[model samples]
Target chain A: MIELKDVYFSYPSGAVLEGIDLTVKKGEYVGIMGHNGSGKTTLARLITGLLLPGKGYVRVNKIFTTDSERLLDIRRSTGMVFQDPDAQAIGETVEEDMVFGLENLGLPVPEIDTRIEKYLDLLGIRELRHRNIRTLSGGQKQLVNLAAVMVMEPECIILDEPVSMVDARCRKMILQHIARLNHEGTAIVHITHDPEELIRCHRLIVLSRCRVTNQGTPHEVFGQLLDEKKMDVPAPYAISRKLGLSPVLTIKALLEELCRSRSGN
Target chain B: MSIEIRQLTHIYDASTPWETIALDRIDLTISKGTVFGLVGGIGSGKSTLASLMAGLGTPAHGSITIDGEPPDPGRNVGILFQQPEDFFFEKTLFEDMASGLLHLGLTEEEVHKRIHSTLDLLGLDHQILDRSPFHLNRGTLRLAAFATVLTMRPGYLILDEPTASLDPKSRKRLVEVIKRISGDIAIIYISHRLQEVVAVSEYLAVLEQGKVAFTGTVPGYLDWATGQDAWEYLPVLNQVMYGLQRLGFDVDLNVACLEDAVEQIRLSLERT
Candidate 1:
């Protein structure tokens, strides 16, 4: 659903991304990870058409992102969640924020209301509908941001460190919702620094020093890409490896392996 | 300096429609040279408590004392806000660091000397003094902000989600620096990342709905939180160990880091 073709992007200071070629098929969950200044956010902006590539192109839903005529279509197909929750919000109330994008699209009032209610319930934030956005905590505001984007029913969602501000409880809730949405065939591109969040992603892409250095499944990437690149491995994965066992990303998987081995499986 | 808070209650926009009882009759204390971790979900009064302790705002009820005197936010506490930019407004790092020092009646030479020494303490290069605070990367900005705070040398330091939005390398570096200096200053670390909290903090407090839900050492809180419904608040290592405990594997939930967890798991398996 999303593709980047030999893309090169730069700012006034320096080139950020170079020789990028990638694609995300329908319903694919792609985890993009790299350290700060690794051009990860720039890639997200490029795919969402927020920033045009300096050279080459980015396409969403087979439509060139640079095409002004199809700008609305591009935006409708891909929703981008930014890193900072406070900066991205424009609405005074939670419900208002959820409907902001739809109202901008000039959808019917009843349809917008229906969508707002549906998504808020889906995210378990229905009770926070009328509350002032400023009063909500960082995690709640982020959940509202997610509801705002998902209410529009985009084909693909690009989340840029959505859970970084949230507490562990709310982060899990948000990730579970993202996983469910992806399972329902909406493509997901999650940009983050945490390895725990990366396990659910079907494919992993690592960018470094303005280039794509690694791309593979979670296991493949964790097996060597993380260590070889000096990337941060999740604590569970690192601990399992330290104990001379095959490292598993998730806690549930690790527990299963431990039980199996202890029971002489 | 030690801090003692008793019957603390804070209400934002009180007696109005926007009224929020951010904190309710909370009592706490932070001794010198120890890391006190304040953890809670969003809107659970964590920031309110931090602000109150930092003297950013006045508590509507109760009392706060620093070494048997009323706490002074300006003189006794240094708070690194959730956003680095919140604590900075100058055009350059040098000016920002100087702004805080100028108020202390220090001469230019003295201010520069203090800033340089503070930067050295935080392991920041003096070259960054020429750059704009807005232009630096997140990690550098964080360290720059740290230098600004350390220039004051407040007895109490309040850090709100210090590692959020930071890369692993930056996070590790910041944690190491905090560890290096933790013996001298009392640190009140507020974060949802329980692993980092466990690693840095010697004491713990879990806030729930504007109340102190649990308080104790890392291991004590882990045992208490594991049986509670707030499973997400548990650190990744503890969560995995809790799962192992559920599966009938006698595992210790107190392992703080990956290395500790590895040792614990090895010993558990060998015993099995």
Candidate 2:
């Protein structure tokens, strides 16, 4: 669980995020979106205890974000995967890397090995266990990063553009995984600019100029974006138009709708 | 002032296990002052082709000539690579744009004039001149990236995934700028979306498995590309209409924009 009350954060170049209020309950998956420099990442840091709020209070699992004594416990409850895969993955080998976080958590040795395999299989990275970190591509590196944190079995994960640099296939896989994790009762806060991924999120939030511009399910937030016509709808816009369907987001859904309608017996 | 390529081949990580033959005996010509669009899924070498044109990378074999000279990364070509954050490092917009021109041997006053004009052309206010490059949002970063490259004034202006992360308003503004700027330089605009390419480009190329699969007019390429499922990023209305028609329903493939589709549906309803 997370809670923020009347928070304010600023950098030297004026104020990045000011007078913010937010809350993320346990087992809730939220996606945060913005164009850029929208204070989305700043908010992420505030939640993860990376930055102390200049004003107001942030609570993770009922513990204050600024409480030094509760910092380790609060941090243990959440794990993060950044946009750049290279920045994480400190270990040389995948298996060793996965175990590094476990070691820091100070779990027992045999249990650590079990967790390594368990999460590696959970994230589908078992085959890459023995590979060197540098040999993996951008997507593979990200998967390993996921596996590493997952072994610790944190209650929630905060992913900042986890699939930004990845190929389309991997992007789909990661999005599906995020959905699955959310279904399994793990909270997720995904920050990204890609709409294809945004459509997959359960609840979406938009940050503009460091304030919560909008918050709702993907349908609500992006529906407003479409209404503004500031952004173009996905491909097959014409197909939806012909069918007179209310602008479905993905192609598969549109196809299904068309199939059902054309069979109008 | 025409562009020509003959048997262009590019290899990445040559001789290593990851040696990828990016471009393979590709030959093509793009007339100057035209929008040439490029498309492909990831690792298809579309970016590689742009890099070659922008002079960021050398062709392993064959030749590329722009205005009768080879494409040189260090000179003559202005390239905005895929990741906007990669090429940016300076503190201020002025410094970022001036970094490239300092080597071109321009006078200080000349650099200032060029920088201000380019910023104005991009519709960025002069106040943004003093802001940190990193402080700007993704859309601003993208425009700043373009401004930085355009300040160099190369014969060829290239942008890889130029508008990928941009919002709608900025995207429209940037597209307008590109259209206005195209008359003076060859624009090698690389994007995955066939629709955007169709809207802005006179010429088009689709990269598949490291080669040019389709190269012709934008409409011609889209006609072929729309059939490939468009990697699922293709517009919603187009696919819906096409899928319905595939199942023996009536649908028009000519509807490029969403409003036209909406109007078509409402009109069809009245007729029915």
DockQ each:
0.60, 0.33
DockQ of 2: 0.33
Tens digits of per-residue lDDT, candidate 1, B217-236, equal: 88788878887745687888
lDDT at B245, model 2: 53
Model 2 chain B poorest ten-residue lDDT run: B231-240
**lDDT per model vs. reference:** 0.85, 0.74
List model 1 lDDT by residue over A1-265, tens digit each: 8999999998765789999999999999999999877889889999999899989999888899899899889998899888877767888888778778999889999999898989988878777788888777667778888888888888899999888877877787888989999999999999998877988899999998999988899888877764685798777678777776678887777887788889983
Error of 2 at B224 (Å): 2.1
Candidate 2: Cα lDDT at A43: 85
Using DockQ as the measure, which candidate wins? 1
What proportion of the true contacts does each candidate reproduce? 0.68, 0.29
Candidate 1 lDDT for residue A230: 78
State the lDDT of candidate 2 residue by residue for A1-265, as single tens digits. 9888989998877787878887887788888877667787788888989999999999999999889988998889989886657777788889888888889888899999898988788766676787767645445677888777766778889888776544455566768888888888899888877666767667788777778877788777766766665444354443464456766667677667655654553
What are the TM-scores, per candidate, against the unseen true structure? 0.93, 0.82
